[model samples]
Target chain A: MAGQPPKVDVPILKDLTIDNITENVHRINSQGSDPRLKYILERLVTHLHDFARETRLSTDEWMAGIEFLTAVGKKCTDVRQEFILLSDTLGLSLLVDSIDHPKPPSSTEGTVLGPYHTHDAHDLDLGSAISGDPSGTPLLCLCTVKATSGAPIADAKVDIWETDSKGSYDVQYSDYSGEPDGRAVIKSDKEGVFWFKAIVPVPYSIPFDGPVGKMLKVLGRHSWRPSHMHFMFEKGGFDRLITTLFLRGDPYETSDAVFGVKDSLVIELGTVSAEQAKKYGVEEGTKLLTHDFVLVTDEETRKLRDEEALKAMRKLGREGMTIINGQLVPDVD
Target chain B: MAGQPPKVDVPILKDLTIDNITENVHRINSQGSDPRLKYILERLVTHLHDFARETRLSTDEWMAGIEFLTAVGKKCTDVRQEFILLSDTLGLSLLVDSIDHPKPPSSTEGTVLGPYHTHDAHDLDLGSAISGDPSGTPLLCLCTVKATSGAPIADAKVDIWETDSKGSYDVQYSDYSGEPDGRAVIKSDKEGVFWFKAIVPVPYSIPFDGPVGKMLKVLGRHSWRPSHMHFMFEKGGFDRLITTLFLRGDPYETSDAVFGVKDSLVIELGTVSAEQAKKYGVEEGTKLLTHDFVLVTDEETRKLRDEEALKAMRKLGREGMTIINGQLVPDVD
Candidate 1:
């Protein structure tokens, strides 16, 4: 009742078969003005139909999938992204990150930006404490920002956030007041040094009260991610880095439920002596985490990304695919 | 925080690459107690990862897909199922129906069960009128239920429903009254005959106020379905039949938006005489539609379904797959 028949010429689709349905769908969707959308949808439909056919998927199984996806969508809210969780758990997030954000060997590797990041983190001076709660072992984080050429990146903005000893972000609380905790924004000094004091993060489960949690149970997989601190760096003329540092000894480090851990991103924490802690205005026996983050310049990043795309296009060309007006299309010669 | 690490021996998932990620996922999920679930997930993950790699899917495109699925999920409600509509438009519903309900050559072919059926309907005597509205031209439908052997099946429960003159189902109205209109359930007599009077259904658009509607627009496809009447039949020893009869001359008969039109289901209506109309207690100038619905006995249907499953398993076996304890698994040497 809300739409009229097509005013343009459209094909009459009848008696669709599994073997011919994919082609018909592609034909119908070819009418879209956006060539990129048409390309993506064509590939999606092809893969979906192929999957169903190869598996000989039953109606009950299809219904189960539909219900599962519906529950996942219904579980999403302002602070929670269940779909992203699903992608992460399925290893898709890492695949996309690897393809889109390929970096030079000297540059730091990036990982999934979990759903807990917020824009309201408090901006504090270097070496200031970020935690409001007076629990957990105090940690002194000493970090340096540098270019791939080993030059100091002065005045770089570093955003950091992590869970408390109880393994929960501040926003996860039911009675969360509109205040930031265990998170902050700090700037690197002229020497490219930036330090902060906060509680050491604890191994935590990705929110397990939703549909994703139920899926993990069905997969016989755990939901625990290694205890890790998140860092996002932004600077002029450089690529923004979104990454995490996993504590080397965390039980879940190697088998992170979200599949976010990389060997280079894992680090061992050292002990901060009383004398060294005095310089950081912290108590004795505090945990120490020291690391240097290497960043690629924006120009270099763009070049690398373009090269990767060209490489992919070449690979696809070998398989009889070609790019037409910025859209990947079959080479139908 | 709510879940501990897996108590069982779980594989350490680390450094996942696009090529290796699918196998790792399958390995992790292989610990599930249900072999069928594991088999389905393995195939799903394989197809999903293959799609990404073949297309070189970018981060932006992946995020767009996630957002689209979330929107589709959010649009579902108690009375509306947007996911089903999405499945219908993508031809998955039809594909599943075609595979699951393969009929003998003598039996009527079945089509998609559009997401508009309801369990609640008024049961009436033979030749009773179904429409509460008095506006549209009256139609008299004559139907018979017969077995594949041409034996009349007595007392078959025939359920019928359709749209009114305005091309809208009663439930589609915001202020829908509780009364039923243009829909009813009638039973066949000893001769397997049932007749009912109702308004002639008109071509109508699927609900286009939701995410699926937007998707159709993006694909440059119209949402109009041909004018059709739904019929479902049930008997003690026969398989339930869910199907529709499309008006042969309707503009969308060849290209139903939902890909639901089957060649065998297209039908033509005849003109009823004044005297013929009086037999049904309707005014003169009534339209007439007569058809016989052939049903396969439950035992015969079971045999056909088993044969289909065996054929699929054999096909997969030729592709290095096997059914193990009712679960499809890779036949590794």
Candidate 2:
């Protein structure tokens, strides 16, 4: 090579086209910031720009998206999280959740972190009831938390929340009714057991009075989330598990709108006699569900799980036959 | 067929994956909303979902986008339009402008309708000055509006706004200093001729104090807009033309941050003698520009131009080689 081609500073060109946008995103040499944040944001910009290109999005369409986002933001309050609901309905939440807390075999799988989980889950004693109200079907939950190595994970915090039998979260009910009623937290005893009596979970549609609801209706899809109880088990030195347990035979179980249902998380409820219910100081003819959760023992396992899930999820997205403008086209990864 | 397969409602299957998101997008139907808006929104959803899949965006990444958008919305007020600025920097404003008002070959091609156009231009006589401030370089404008057939278009409203030589628009300065001072509306006389004395256009960066600014900095791109005067010519029958004429040889002319510069919109400025400036009631040594705009007389031409430009612009986006994770990938369109 007698003559070397001059080095053209390509990334700093600032062309402002979709092409330049692609270059600029990668060229972001952040001097100081969380490297993790930078990595996430850079990838996000690449995908967003690529999306704009693939659709050949017009300005009106872009503006419309902005307006919809603004409306969603405005709709958010202390009780309502339109963003999470948006992510849930779009299925991005599932993609993220699946990657975030990947479950090893025999481990409890996670679901959509629905907008109803409050950190202040009231501490309940073992075998105590979660709800005070005697509404809907009576139910009892008995949970055991343990390490994948089959050892008890004593003193772990088991956070539990679920909709009432009618399928409404406490926050939503508390807006007009009093404080939300059917949620609580209990610590696992030395035997890694925690139990609570509460109403059974039933299928419920997501709140559809806002933009997300409008999107669901327009897309000709149901806003129903399969009936399930939310759960999170946390202990120092062990990977945290964010999950949901679905009733085995709920009608919407297989067709959950947010794709939160998983096989391992489902449990069958058996009828408990009035005498058994009275022993727990609850209503007669209660239903009881027993569940055991296995957590990954090491942090490396959890990280590896997340990495593997991301790869698998990416492959799933890449394999789907994509449709655009009413035409079926193979997705290009 | 001996056996008919069970009819499955295809679109309602809410499998929260990229493929399902793609399917759901094409399934949208409008029983009653504006059909055009419905179509646009459906395409938007498809492209957006594909983008997420292509990137395999994590939850933290998605939430970061939400937070950025929420902050952008919160930063917006009556005096500041952060959304418009965001659109401008992303080159979306120009794409929209080109489609909304297509320029016939002889007609003036429009540029980004920068956020400063206040339609309330004071109807000044032919030779009034837009800025009374004596701080910057002086300039006089002479404009002639004509139809594509070379016919003078009388009674056309010529609304104009520009930043001073100091590169600050009146709206931005108004808050700290006082009333916005550098914008005015002057009607063309019967001969389709109008002139106004004001400061020559100077390159200016967009107001970079909000989330958009933070975004620009992080993206490693300048927020500077090329110097140009915003113009709008409207009549009863002609397509309204929104344009900006950059000072011919400005260094940033080719690299406009908003992609607002057009070959036809750049015009060179000639210096006028002190006596000539006095005739126009301005300072002694004033800059002068004589530019004529040709307008498309019919609606059909405008629509056709927009349709054609959209095709070309979209093709430009689709042509770029997309690289993700160091892999040169072909965009799934």
Compute each candidate's TM-score over C-alphas.
Answer: 0.93, 0.78
CAPRI-style quality class for the chain A–B interface of candidate 1 = medium
lDDT for each residue of candidate 2 in A148-249, tens digit (9 for 90 to 100): 778988999888888776677778864545454677778999999878877878878888888877766765566676678888888988777778888877
Q: Given the true complex, what DockQ would model 2 score?
A: 0.19
| Chain B TM-score for all candidates, comma-separated | 0.92, 0.84
| Cα-based lDDT at residue B113, candidate 2 | 78
Score residue B254 of candidate 2 by CA lDDT. Answer: 57
What local lDDT score does residue B327 receive in model 2, on the 0 to 100 scale?
Answer: 23
lDDT of 1 by residue, B1-73 (tens): 3457554587977576655777777777787777567767877887788777767677778888889889988
lDDT of 2 at A182: 78
Best candidate, lDDT = 1
